[model samples]
Target: MTTTVVTHQPGIIAQSQVVVQVTERDWSTSLFGCFEDIGSCLCGWLCYPCFACQVATNAGEHCITPCCVPGAMIALRLKVRARLNIQGSLCNDCLVDTFCGPCSACQMHREINNSSNGHLQ
Candidate 1:
């Protein structure tokens, strides 16, 4: 599936904001990696288990797009997307929930907290 989003790149000076037409591929690649990478910081906001879902969808010859699932898949996808859009740029309810996994934010926070605590020892 393809989605389009408009992004503005901050310019070096005022009135220099460059509006770029971002395509899904740009985000999708990172999003896909978020699902595959065990250490992604945006995993929670995009918890689609995209890898597994792609395999299942491929086997059935279904549409190779960003489709929604239920249960674990949905839950995971939401978590991943949440992590990516943690700045309140996106909403959790707007996404389809189907999977239940450690959200990227939760994981990142845990890691950060652990690292900091370790230094206090």
Candidate 2:
């Protein structure tokens, strides 16, 4: 006697075939690797809010949105992760934003830079 397995969801296997293959990639820069870009580090150190706003603007978000809304950085991080197919969770985003806010911002800046070919516009 043989057992047969069936999936209840239709086209589950077919959908997998239709899915586009995307290569997983890590963040272009490390969170604490701010020294790699002295300009960004100085901007983040001298005026954190300005740096955050610049990052937000570069990401197509309103300049003041990050300042007015709480957890905006986390949301931006998640967006960047999804766009790049990077593996990360909301909890991780939150933790990174909470513990190393400046570093996280710098990393996001670097990611945007790498993705956009050094154009933050």
Best of the candidates, lDDT? 2
TM-score of 1: 0.20
Model 2's lDDT to the true fold?
A: 0.85
lDDT of each: 0.36, 0.85
Output the worst ten-in-a-row residue range by lDDT, candidate 1.
Answer: 23-32
Model 2 spans with C-alpha error above 4 angstroms = 1-17, 118-121
Could you say which candidate leads in TM-score? Answer: 2
- Give lDDT for model 1: 0.36
Question: Which pairs of residues clash in candidate 2, taking residues 3 or more apart in a chain or in different chains?
Answer: none
**Candidate 1: tens digits of C-alpha lDDT, residues 1-121:** 9997867655645465788853321122322333444544343445534533442332232323334434433443344334343222233423412132334223333432333441111
